[model samples]
Target chain A: MMTREKFEEAVLPPVVALLVAMLVGDALILLFGQSPGAVYRMLLEGTWGNAYGLGQVLYKATTLTFTGLAVAIGLRAGLFNIGAESQLAAGGFMAAVVGLAIPAGVPALLLLPVYFLAAALAGGAVGALPGWLKARFGAHEVITTIMLNFVVLALLNYLISSRFKVPDTLHTRELASGRLPRLDAFLPAFHGSAANVVLLLALAAAVLVGWFLFRTRAGFELRATGLQPAAAEYGGVKVGRVWWHAMAISGALAGIGGLNYVLGYKGYYEEGFATGAGFLGIAVALVGRSHPVGIVLAALLFATLSQGGLAVNALVPKQMVDVLQAVVIIAVATSVPEVRRLLRGFRRSNDA
Target chain B: MMALAFLTQTLRIAIPYLFAAAGGVMTERVGIIGLTLEGYMLGGAFGAAVGSLATGNPWIGLAAGALGGLVFALLYGLGAIRFRADQVVVGIAVNLLAIGLTRVLLRFLYDSSSNSPRVPGFNVTSSGSGFGALAQNPLVWMGFLALPLVAWILYRTPLGLRIRAVGEHPAAAISLGVPVTRVRWTAVALSGILAGLGGAYLALDQHQFTDQMTALRGFIALAATIFGRWDPKRVALACLLFAAAETLQIHLQGVGAFPSQFVEMIPYVLTIVALAGVVGRAVPPAALGRAPE
Candidate 1:
């Protein structure tokens, strides 16, 4: 029932919230006895100060982009998929297994697809459980997904410490001979950097997701189910199917997020390597208003903050970064009502 | 001997969760699903530690912990009831805020991150033998004793009727002249007090406090609230079930039966299985997460 104009109107609130959050964050920096102007300069400098920093920023952004998309997809379907962390862990573990198990004689081109597929399958299966339960039994996904997160974490911890433990290290075995090619080798011009072609793939995935959600019939059905399930069912939409499909797709997206980590940065699975990406993905999805393009922008912005946050640790406590992220999420969530009121007021004023 | 040890361990682990879940049932019965139970518990633990450390009196710490819970519950009530914020989002925010604020305060107060100084233990005495072989913390006994009392308050009291009425049908209750908002707020605040006391027990009973010590207990309490089907008696039973699982894991570890990591995973895994099976038909309050119009 949201017209194009109304959708645009809905978009303005998150944007304003982001601006206000930034202002508040800057104020917080000042309260911490740091110069806001200098901090901003340092943030930009840290993120884009040089080639290495930019590469790290892009590298971090690539993983976040996928996770953000995963969360956004679930949000669109009215599901709060907090299990992305566990799904990512599962996917990363599986991908590491696949990457290591492949025959050394195999070509990189052939093995890459296998690694990606395995990760996607593992993550998708993890996601499917809560999705199926929600669809079949009307169970709340939030509680089940969170519980599953713990289950997955425990399972991963067991595997890494026991069966999958590399002989010498606390992580899995090094990736097989035929795995994702090194980013430096793939892009000769960007020598000695973590930035890879994965960024492009992430961008392409975002575009495809955007088109799918905005243009396709399935997307329309999913949105309809989310906005008003009763009405969607009345319109002959299979609400359960949409929920299942959306969650499956959401899981796959989160799985790819795990894939990005292995394929781009670490190239191996380490226990507890993903600190809080899945949870942070929730904040990203919320800040972006569950739109693919918005998610991409938000992910990049967060990636910059995270990267810059590390560089400014000497001047400010690292916890400040978390404070900023928390502020943004709180501001956006709390501003929704005000935004609606503002929009209604504007409309009334225009009519008057 | 093993069984006795297990029973004692289970009581110790279950007491905090029992208090929290009892509180959760009270709030949920009033139509507000409290997600910040963990935060309140953590606040209580920290507050108790700080107060006892400063005052050299464990009782004062207990009171301070309850006060901390009261303050947090008030914030949640204001946001969810007064401002009509999304309950779940507010819950998540409260949790994150608790994490950030706790860390900040720890650094400010203790100058360290790991553990606080030990305090005087709670008062308790063990006696008898055989079935009574298990000596219990006085707080543990109090937690158990509170169950029937809570059940009484929920089912036998006039205030309980008003609370249930508001939860079930706010408009109808309001039409009947019940102060719906006041009842809901009271339920929330009372839940906070219980959760806070649970947290205080963690510090005062255990004789120490540590960062993240109440890890995920709040979530477990919420799960217990659901598993109990929003009934005080059932919730206490659920808490005991979860606590038994935790106690079994600890016992297995004490005897070196399995790797500690594997033992630690039992509670989480069992919770998932329990949710999938026993929690299948649990119905939450009809308007549990909704804001009053």
Candidate 2:
């Protein structure tokens, strides 16, 4: 367990960033001629005041958590897997296909695991290609991953619009099996919201990832390679292999992230379902300091902002939240080292 | 005849990529990674649309676009250069900022979310002269001129040598009395200006600014810069090649020869393949993406 001091050190930068972002947001709101306090009050009430609002927050948080973990894993391996958006889309598309085509006799419980595995495999395939290219050909993962996003999105669009379209719509048919149960069904407080069992799955995945990263030899190798490839190579670690494994695992996590949207709520693959979640994951990873618990808290914070944006959309431009989020990410990332130094100085003064 | 028609479309499409790639080459050459080209382009597009709509002049719109790009580059420089923030993170932040800022601005300016009203486009006169079609838009002519101009500036000037020198070894350049941050800021500003022009062309050509009008063209241009070995002339050639692919995709869509989505994927897939091929052969600037001490 982290001591109180350690927790404060870990959390201070993001909190400062968030506060700074809100100040900037308040200025923006004032520019738009709206009362920032009123808008903020509405946002707070909208997201946390009712069961439905709380449920929506959890639903969004579920997706954010998975994608955040995906980005965190990539960062661990020193790769910026911006293709998580595409990977999530691919995984969701594959899951939709499997869910739709599975035998009617198969139980939901059995098919759930199949959906998860298929999504991971599909996402992993795309992820590993970039990783292999980086390891083998010395191509930068950033450009390759970015290029793959466009390719995958176009592929998904083709598959859904032409091959698997439901008559005249831009979505696939609703799946017959492997649909996750709505959280409201089990917990009445989530009634009418899209919150589902995927929230639990996301939390479990986070714990699993934390355990793997801290306890596993493969994870250590991956981290070592990221920190110092020459040193890792000298230490006899297969750095290239670590790259492939890390990227594949990162992609798998993003693929499973699709479950929050496709299986949990939509029950079908739809156009633009994974929009912006992948990019927002970068913010979550940075704000959380690339830790599992930090990621969960960061995800929830962002989810609340998004959910609250909808609540105050009538009064102030909800786009303010986007500005705030960007500001927070930039502020935290840029100020963390300086903040750390400041804290150290204060500690030294106290010691003296 | 068919080839001529294809070539015309290719030239038209390649202009934006050429402009953006030229900017990207300069930025990377000056040892500053510019992933914010996408954001710069988006800002330029929005600025051009609003400017043209408000002023009824394409030239004013062009200036507005460049100004928009410069503004974004300044913000980026503030973070990446002044504060020593991570360039990659700053680039990503710029993109998100552009997207969000443009959307909000669009809502305020046009009272709509998806697109802006059509602005006056340049006149296309067909006088049956040989140069009639080519003279359709002055911007296209500008695109033709940009390649050589950038090449001359980058290859044949003292400033060019200094730019390259600062990129290669900033410490050495500083020792020689070169201001490293100023040079980088100038390069980034130039990148923004060119990318803004590219974005303005999209808006002025289409006669409207839609959300994300630049799409992934900025990134494609960045890829082109990489594929072309970061040389101005080669980057222009890569832009033309990618543009040819895009023109073919349009033609293919008309004939239903291939799935349109597959056609859409061609440029990106080719970029990936090209990047992989060039990794060993085309070396990046020695100090690319490194901050000057």
Candidate 3:
């Protein structure tokens, strides 16, 4: 009963809502006793004016890109993966341990792969617990994921404070021993930017994920399972396997975000280091409408907001940025009906 | 003596969770998952703190807290029920809004981020002998009483039937001339009231109003609701279980039995294990998360 034109009709509302939100956000700036035009200019300059600022934006984007992909994958499969936060924490913690534990003389080629693998495995394990429960026991992912989040937070708190306490500090040991070699020399151009070779890896993963979702038979099975589990089961798709695989992929992507954080920013993990990056990934996925390319753009937009928000802190409270973010999400969500009605009206007008 | 002390501590801690879980049961029973419990609880805490400080009366503070929660919950109901917004997203937004609003209000009211002026505690009744030492805050008794009251109201009353029917099959109920939206709205409002009371109790009874006062009790209440199979009595028992774990962690610290951090994790770890084990079989309200057509 659905058509491509109807799909387009559904999409238009969110886009219009976003544009309106930007305008309203600017208006909010003016109301807050700041010049909207000046603020916008500062935001642009802070996010992308200098090479360093642009690099920081890109670095932040790279982390968001991976986590956004993680959330998007789960959403596409009809699973709300709120567990991304915990999974990311687990992955980052595991990567930190592995990166720190390795002897100093290990080859970068081997060490990098090992650290990534460790991170992925840790994250995947956390994701699989909920996936298994959902598939086998009919447990809801939302509740399970949320409960797991508390468990992970408590566990991380214990680990960082006691077991893995880096000598005298509350943080882990610095990454002097097993640091991921900076891509500055290799790339030469994007120096001072954490936009490393990992971005390429993230891009490849995104392409592979896209291909798996759209072009492959398993991808079709996953989508079908998500659309209607009863129908998919009747049609002979392995519903359980799809849930597991989707969650595994989702968790791995989230883990990659953690790895990116460690490798790019602190070069070591600290307590509460990833600070809700996993949750922000949810906003990224939603704003992007769960598309790969859309998520990339959403991440960049969010990164810009993050940087710009800090820049404007001199004039307005930084909390206003969060308010704007929340407004954008609400506006986008509410736009669905308005956009649909507008399109219907437009078509009627055209017909008339 | 130690066991008695432990039991008393557990009951005291469980009271707030019991209140919030009861609210969750009411909303979920009407086919609406009440994720705004956190917001309501926090708002209640803030309202109670401010009201008690301004009026110098615990009861007034409690009423104010409940009112704050009711207002926020109504906003949530309007968005989710009237506008047909995504319930989960709206719930998360409400939680974020509550946090921001509370912070902003805190700054406006106290001019300090750390603590609010202490208010008078709720009056407590002392039992004669064996449990006299264990006699806790009056709100604990009120919370316990609410369990049976809620159960009776939910299962035995005509209003309860309507609420259940709305959750189970809203369209069918509507066809039968029931006001489905009204039932859902009322249920959500009631949820807010209960969560707000829980929050007020947290501030007035346990500790003075602090920013992190309601730390994750809202989520824990949600967990208890699911764990208890959305039944008032079972939810109360689940709250007791969590509270017992918390009490044990505290008691263990007194005896130097386990490290503080590890002991603190006991409740969370146990919750995950319990959820993985027991939650798989429990069926939620049939219409939960689905808007009425």
Per-prediction TM-score, please? 0.89, 0.95, 0.89
What local lDDT does model 2 show for residue A294? 90
Per-residue error for B267 in candidate 2, Å, reads 2.4
Sort the candidates on DockQ, descending order: 2, 1, 3
Q: Ten consecutive residues with minimal summed lDDT in candidate 1 chain A?
A: A178-187
Per-candidate interface DockQ score: 0.40, 0.65, 0.36
- Give the alpha carbon lDDT tens digit for every residue of A116-178 in model 3: 898899888888888887887777777777778778777887889877877877678866555
lDDT by residue for model 2 over B103-198, one digit each (tens)?
888877787778999977677765433245556788888888776777887789988788899888898999999888888888888889888888
Regions of candidate 1 where Cα sits further than 4 Å from its true position: A1-12, A15-41, A167-169, A178-195, B117-138, B145-149, B174-179, B254-280
Worst 10 residues of 2 chain A by lDDT: A101-110
Cα deviation of A276, candidate 2, in Å: 1.0
Candidate 1 structure quality by residue, lDDT tens digits, A235-342: 999998888788888887778777666766677889886657887787778777787877887888778878888888666655567656765666667666667777
lDDT for each residue of candidate 1 in B1-293, tens digit (9 for 90 to 100): 76776677787788898888878888888988767898889878888888888898877888888887787788778667766766776666666666655665565566555678777765555553223422445566667866576688889999999988888888888899999888988899988888988888898877888877888898888878877778887788888888887777676765877766664555455545555565457766777777776
Tens digit per residue, CA lDDT, model 2, A1-352: 7887677778898888988899988888887789989988899899989889989999999988988998889898888888888888888888998888875566778888899998999888878889998898877787788889989998889888878988888889888777889988988887899999999989998999898888999888888888899999999999889888888998888898888888999889998899998888888888988899999999999999989989999987787777787788778867776677678899899999
**Candidate 3 docking DockQ:** 0.36
For model 2, state the Cα shift of residue A229 in Å: 2.1
